[model samples]
Target: MKTHALGRGAPQVTEFCLGTMTFGTQTDTADAHRQISMALEAGINFIDTAEAYPVNPISAETAGDTEAIIGEWNAANPGRRGEYVLATKVAGEGLGAIRDGAPISRATILEAVEASLRRLQTDHIDLYQLHWPNRGSYHFRQNWSFDPSGQSRADTMAHMEEVLVTIDELVTAGKIGHFGLSNESAWGTAQWLRMAEDKGLPRVVSIQNEYSLLARLFDTDLAELCVNEEVGLMAFSPLAAGLLTGKYQGGAVPDGSRMAINGNLGGRVSPRVWDAVDAYAGIAQAHGLDLTQMSLAWCKTRPFMGSILFGASSVTQLEHILNGLDLTLSDEVVAEIDAAHKAHPMPY
Candidate 1:
């Protein structure tokens, strides 16, 4: 495994970040703990979770269970916490289970960080992220119907400033080490960086947007922004929610899989999505490569990639992905992938 600098001053993290979104729901505590140990043994030093995680079904009861599972591991190990950079998020608006769907504010952020700290059983968080912009986001398959006209610029800036002020306070108090964003647009990210620079507040260190062969919303303006501004991209769903693995091809949904749990796989299933998967799978077969490894390996080749985040329901799956950590795609394969993208752009 290789390491990359998260931001200008943040710690170096492995190129592959272990995602624990299913730690409590799809994955049990014992398996989750084993996965953590396995990831560490394999040289992965970055782990990402969210307060509103274990989200196969995403209910209030199991919302913080994932962090608690991780906390249990932290409590047991007690001494190896320093080996990894732990990152979590403060849920933005529209999650009714948390804060009654309230938008992110200074007060909400304070409350969320406290809860996350307690759940993670850690004194400090390496990276604290705003899960999404308060105004709204175009990610999560919302680009089809996204409308930014309803957002007020003055309100948005005010919210950003208030959050920055809170982040500065958190850093001063040693509650969080750095700040980041998720599901944010290029303009929103630039504004955060601009405000941080102008007011001498904490700089935005990273952005964890959805990036993969199927989901390329981050390729245009956001790609340029990350490359120029040094804000690393923690790409989530690097496998397109398992579509790249070809398990869900031909409408065959395996039992206990993400698709079996949630039929749409978060709006990723469509007529064209299967076709796109077939094209990519064909390319993988032609090159005699595992589709999963090929997809993840391609993510590493991007110049702006900081780390590719992946989640597994079982240790077997994790080991399979870990085995391919060193797989590198040749230029010809990458060229073919680009051509496939041009043909089946935005399949979902």
Candidate 2:
């Protein structure tokens, strides 16, 4: 696996980042640990998890279980902690399980970081991300109804400065190495960079947003911002939540799949989505490529991609992706993908 600089001064991370959202729930502790080991063996040096993880069915009971599971591996493997770059997120507002649904503020970030450190069993986090913007976001299929007219520019700038100050304090105290954002917009990210530059605060290193053949919202504006401003993209849901894996085709929900738990695949199910999957799957078949690997490989080809985050419920699934990490698409195949995307835009 090739490595890329996460941001201006951040550590180098593998193109493929092992995502551990299903660590404690769908996957047991032993299996989760095995996945981590497998990823390391495959030369993957980046791992991402969140405090509000195990999220096929997020709950208060298993809120921090995923981080604890990773912490267990860190505890057991004492000397190999530096083998990989570890990243985790602090949950934003509207999640009842964390901080009683409080918005992300100075106090909330400090509190969340300390708790994340305790659960992760690490003194310093490589990349600490805000799970979502406090004001709200257009991600998670919220763009269709998203409106920013209600937002106050003054309040938003104030919140950004406050968060940046807190992040500065964290870096000074050696709690986090770098800061990032998730589920954010181009405008929001630009303001963060502007504030950091003007105020001499620590600039954001990356943004974790959904980016795949099925979800290309980041391609236009955010893509330009990332490439120009040096903010790398940690693309999540690169497989379109398993839709690109050809698992949910023909309305066949496997017994233990994500579709089984969340029937709509987090609002990704629609008439056009199935057709889009078929088109991409056909492109993979014609080129004799595994769709899962093809989808991931395509993500790596993007200019702003720092790392592509992919999760698996089992070790076997993880192996399938690892075995084909070297797959690269041809020019013809990429053109076909682009054409298919134009034909079936925003399926969800």
Candidate 3:
């Protein structure tokens, strides 16, 4: 488990972050703890979760259950909180169970942070992220027809300012250490940086967007923005929701998989997506590497990647992923990936 500075002078965190979205759903508490223990033993000192976890079928009943599991682990393992860089997100708008589906305003941010802190059983969050922008996002297959022409820039900036002030308050109160953005656009990140600069609020240190060999949407503008601004990219779903793993190859949706619960893989399992996955799988096979490792290694090669967040329903799967932390792709392999990308670009 290689460690990198999250930002200049920021705490060093593992390059591979253990994702706990399945803690209360596909994974039981015992298995979740075992996985955490295994990851820590393997030298992975970063864990990422969310307020609305167990997300294959995110429901009101299971909301916050994942965080509660982590909280329990933290309580059970006293004095271990400082051992890892814990990151979690506060769901933005339209979570009917939380705050009656309200957008994250200053008041709502205060409430959300308090609720998250209680659920996480921790006083300070290493990285707290906005799950998504209040308006909307191009993530989750919404990029095809994403239109931002009609959005109110002034209103968006005002709302961001309000959230930043609340974040400043939270920082002062020792509720959160650093702030981050997720499912956000370059414009949104720019607004955050500008407001934080002018108002002397907290500047974002990371952006947790989906980035994988199959999902290269962040390779262009987000990559450049992160490189120039020093905001690290905490890439989620570097395997494209397991698509790049070749587990669902040939349309085989294995039983008890995320695809089994949500067959489309969150609108990711398209016909063209399989073609792309197979191509990459072939590349990995030719290199005598697991497709999962090849994909994760490709993500680490990116200029702005801070850490890659990967979740596993079982310890066996996690062990395989952990083995790839030191797996670096050669230029020949990268060229093969580029060729594959050009052949099957934007399959999802």
Q: Which is the leading candidate under lDDT?
A: 1
The local distance difference test score of each candidate is 0.93, 0.92, 0.87
Q: Model 2 residue 246 lDDT? A: 100
Candidate 3 has which clashing residue pairs, if any?
none
Candidate 2 local lDDT, residue 96: 62
What's the TM-score of every candidate structure?
A: 0.99, 0.99, 0.97
User: What value does the lDDT take at residue 193 in candidate 1?
Assistant: 96
Candidate 2: worst-modelled 10 consecutive residues by lDDT: 92-101
For residue 253, model 1's alpha carbon misses the true position, in angstroms, by 0.7
lDDT of 1 by residue, 32-142 (tens): 999999999999999999998989888788888999999999999989999999999998785667667789998899999999999999999999999878998888889
**Cα lDDT tens digits for candidate 3, 1-348:** 678888644568988889999999899999999998889988989999988887777888898999999999999999999999999888867355665677888876787788889988999998889988988888878999999887898999899888888888888888898899899888788889889899988888999999888788898888888899988888899888888888888768888998999878888877788788889999999989889999988888888989899999988888888787789899999999999999999998
> How many Å off is the CA of 118 in candidate 2?
1.2
lDDT of 1: 0.93
Q: Please, what are the lDDT tens digits per residue for candidate 2 over residues 1-348?
A: 789799878899999899999998889999999999999999999999998998889887899999999999999999888999999988877466876778889988888888888888889898999998988899988999999999999999999999999999999999989999999999999999999999999999999999999999999999999999989999999998899999999878988889999999899998889999999999999999999999999997799998999999999999999998998888999999999999999999
The C-alpha stretches of model 2 lying farther than 4 A from their native spots are none
Ranking by lDDT: 1, 2, 3
After TM-score superposition, the amount by which residue 238's alpha carbon in candidate 1 deviates from its true location, in angstroms, is: 0.7
- For every candidate structure, what is the RMSD over all alpha carbons to the true structure, in angstroms? 0.8, 0.8, 1.3
